[model samples]
Target: MGRPKQFDPDVAVERAMDVFWRKGYAATSPQDLVDAIGIGKGSLYNAFGSKHALFERALRRYRDDQGAVLVELLERPGPVRERLREVLELLVAMDLADSDRRGCMAVNAAAEVAADDPAAAELVRRMLDRTEGAFRALIERGQRAGEIAADRDAAALGSLLVNTVVGLRLMVRVAEGPERLERVIDAVVDSV
Candidate 1:
């Protein structure tokens, strides 16, 4: 309809996501988005409605794109213990290799706006729910496969692991190296 959108929506959103990811919602200006995404002001407005809408789409994209790995890993048909270990190892690697130390866009959004904005809070809540659900399924699978203690509550354990990941992501934002993460991984896995 409108010139068929000159750029790829995915690529443009990815670029916009990087801008928002680097700078939080309040700080990321429309001009910044224009500069980063190479999209004109009118086109951006027409395509995305507003900055907040664009952010929501980008955040959803992030979870759907980057977070798919977690969902897939959790769903894998394997011993629960090994799957959990794999999840933690992947988490650790993500923390260590994060060049920008962006500390997870979802977590960052949660910290930045969960208390103030209803829309943002809802987004944060959904992200948390999805993450915890993945963990719950993994834990349940472990219990079913005789890998995890049967007495343990999968929902609670999953919530705990989600919290651990949030904490670990936050810690990596300030910590210089992986020493703290190694200790954390050991503690989390050993407990499970």
Candidate 2:
């Protein structure tokens, strides 16, 4: 029989997620995974089957973690617009505060690996859909409460908000400071 494993698979996947978030899929080597996961190469291969398999696990973990936080933020009790502004502001602060400036892992994955990796692409797509759905639901709530204009298209606004966030996350990669991001947030908030 083969030897038993030593590392926690969930913890290893979390570590792998951090490495993948900082380094795009193509740039992160197997050695990087081994080092980040604190396991031998043989152990990692045995646990996850392959780097691609491990990455899928890591990405799904990221989705669950980040997605829950985002949905919670959107679901919080408050004025919908204010809640959305808070969410956007929090994203900006988090992105700016990150020393590595990793931006969103899902966004990075969508840009870097989605075209080539069908599984990764589907994960990213579902993430986008969930976020958009949350935004759409929030917009519908605002309309019902008379906070947002009744005539505005809630679905279209939802799409715009998602696009705005996607753009903001990508822009953070090249941003020098918060000024541009702040302006974008202001414009979006005003539009809503």
Candidate 3:
């Protein structure tokens, strides 16, 4: 009865992720998704429910992938400041590598839809929460080990770092230079 599914769902979602990453959710239509994902309208709906659902899935995937990388990077043996620098460095690298200049899918979504749509907003919120949590934990460990200032509140520092990170992603869209980003990273580490 139904046409056999040709595209791998994960691959399709990754493609959709790129499209949505480039164009915010409000600007992206179902036709855009169909074209980008190479799946028919009927199949797209049947497989992923709707554009909103697909976006949710894609954002989740992005979060999981980024989270895994951040965990590994933070886990590796290095000074906390170096770990922080490496994290920002990696982000700059990704931004520079992308020819299309897609800043960040999650950050873009957070900017565009986080205030209007509940589900979409929640996804973005969760992403920020996870990022803040990671930074907070790292800061806590750094303080305990005398790697950072013990007087600094890791919670506040974590929030600040999360904001800085998202700002870095947004900044990449308009400005890009390794030296510039490294300077910002230095300032962030100094503040911590």
Candidate 4:
């Protein structure tokens, strides 16, 4: 029989996630995983099968942890526009505040791994779909309450909001300050 594991797999995955988030998949080495997870190479393989498998788990963990924040912000009780503004503002704040400037993990994964990795692409796509759906639902709520124009298409608006967020997240990687992001927020909120 195999030996019992010494470390918590969940904690290991979280650590791996941090490493992957800070460094894209191609740049992260096996030794990086070994050091971050505090496990030997063989044990790491035994626990997660391979680097790709471990990255998948880490991405899923990011989805559960970071992706949930966007959903929660959108679901907060308030005017739809205000809630959307808060979501955008919070994203800017969080992205800027991160010392590593990692930007959105899902977004980074989409840009880095989505082309060559189908599983990772699908995972990122599903997160985008869920986020767009949440925005669509919130927009519908606003339309029902007469806050948003009834003539506006919620689906299209939702897609635009998702696109805007995607751009904002990517932009934060190169953004010099909050000024440009604030303007983007103003323009998007006004358009909605």
Candidate 5:
């Protein structure tokens, strides 16, 4: 019989998520994952199969944890515009506050490996789709509440907001100050 394994796979995946978030898929070495997860290289492969496999798991973990937070924030009780601003502002703050300047992991993965890797691309696409749907729901709520014009297209606006968020996250990595992000937030929320 095979030897019983040690270390929790869930915790290992969480640690791997952190590593992949900090270092893009191509840049992170297997040793990096082993060191981050506090496991031997053999154990890491035995548990996750390979670096790419581990990365896929890590990306999914990121989706279930960090990615879901945005939807939760959007779903909070408040005016749609106010909630949108709050969620967008919070995301900008988080990205700016990170000392490592690592932007959204899904966005980074999409930029790094999604072109050549179908699995990574699907994961990123699913995240974008989910976020867009949340934004659409919020917009519909606003329209029903008479906060937003009824004639406007909620679905299109949702896509625009998701694009805005993607831009905001990428901008956080290079922004020298919060001024740019603030302007962006103001412009997008006001437009919505």
Candidate 6:
């Protein structure tokens, strides 16, 4: 064997995720990843195969880490409107609190490379679908509980909520205050 790795692969992926999250796949150089992960270029490629592969890993990590939480949040027991509003507000809080204003990594990835990169597009699509599913289930639950109009289309509303999140995340990337985002969240919750 060549020798044991001096650092953890998992930690490297986490650090790589941060670099990719902040700069995006297209913008992040191989040097940037090496600088962030503190690994040699050859070591990085040898470990992860390539930057694309590492980006995929980082995207998956983001989905599994951040995306799953949104689903769990929506699944919390309570009035659907309240749960929905809370989740949206939580997203807003998170995006605003990020000093780098990195926004959602998945969203940024999609915006930057989804048109040309099928892998990134699919990953982002899945994240959107998962969030949409959560929103749909919550809406259906609300309808069953007599909170939402029985005839309202839950699927369409679910997609709308996903759009709401995507838009909110991107908007906050350049936002100076929370007022517009707060209003948008309130309007979306009311719509649901």
lDDT score for residue 119 of model 5:
98
What's the lDDT for residue 109 in model 4?
Answer: 97
How well does candidate 2 match the true structure, expressed as C-alpha RMSD? 1.6
Candidate 2 residue lDDT tens string, 20-115? 999989999999999888888989998999999999998999999998899889988899889989999899889989999999999999999999
Q: Which stretches of candidate 5 lie over 4 Å from their true place?
A: 1-5
Clashes of each: 0, 0, 0, 0, 0, 0
- In TM-score terms, candidate 3 sits at 0.92
Deviation of model 5 at 5, angstroms: 7.0
What do the candidate models score in CA lDDT, each in turn? Answer: 0.85, 0.93, 0.86, 0.93, 0.92, 0.93
Which residue pairs show backbone clashes in model 5?
Answer: none
lDDT of 5 by residue, 1-192 (tens): 967458999999999999889988888999998888888899998899999999999999999898788888888899999999999989998898999999899999988999899999999999999999999999999999999999999999999999999998998999998999999999999998
In model 2, the runs with Cα more than 4 Å from the true position are 1-5
Model 1: weakest 10-residue lDDT segment is 1-10
- Scanning candidate 5 in windows of ten residues, the lowest lDDT window is 2-11
Better of 1 and 2 by lDDT: 2
Mind giving the per-residue lDDT tens digits that candidate 3 earns over 114-167? 888888888788888988888888888899889998998999998998898898
**What's the TM-score of every candidate structure?**
0.92, 0.96, 0.92, 0.96, 0.96, 0.96
Candidate 4 runs further than 4 Å off: 1-5
Ranking by lDDT: 4, 6, 2, 5, 3, 1
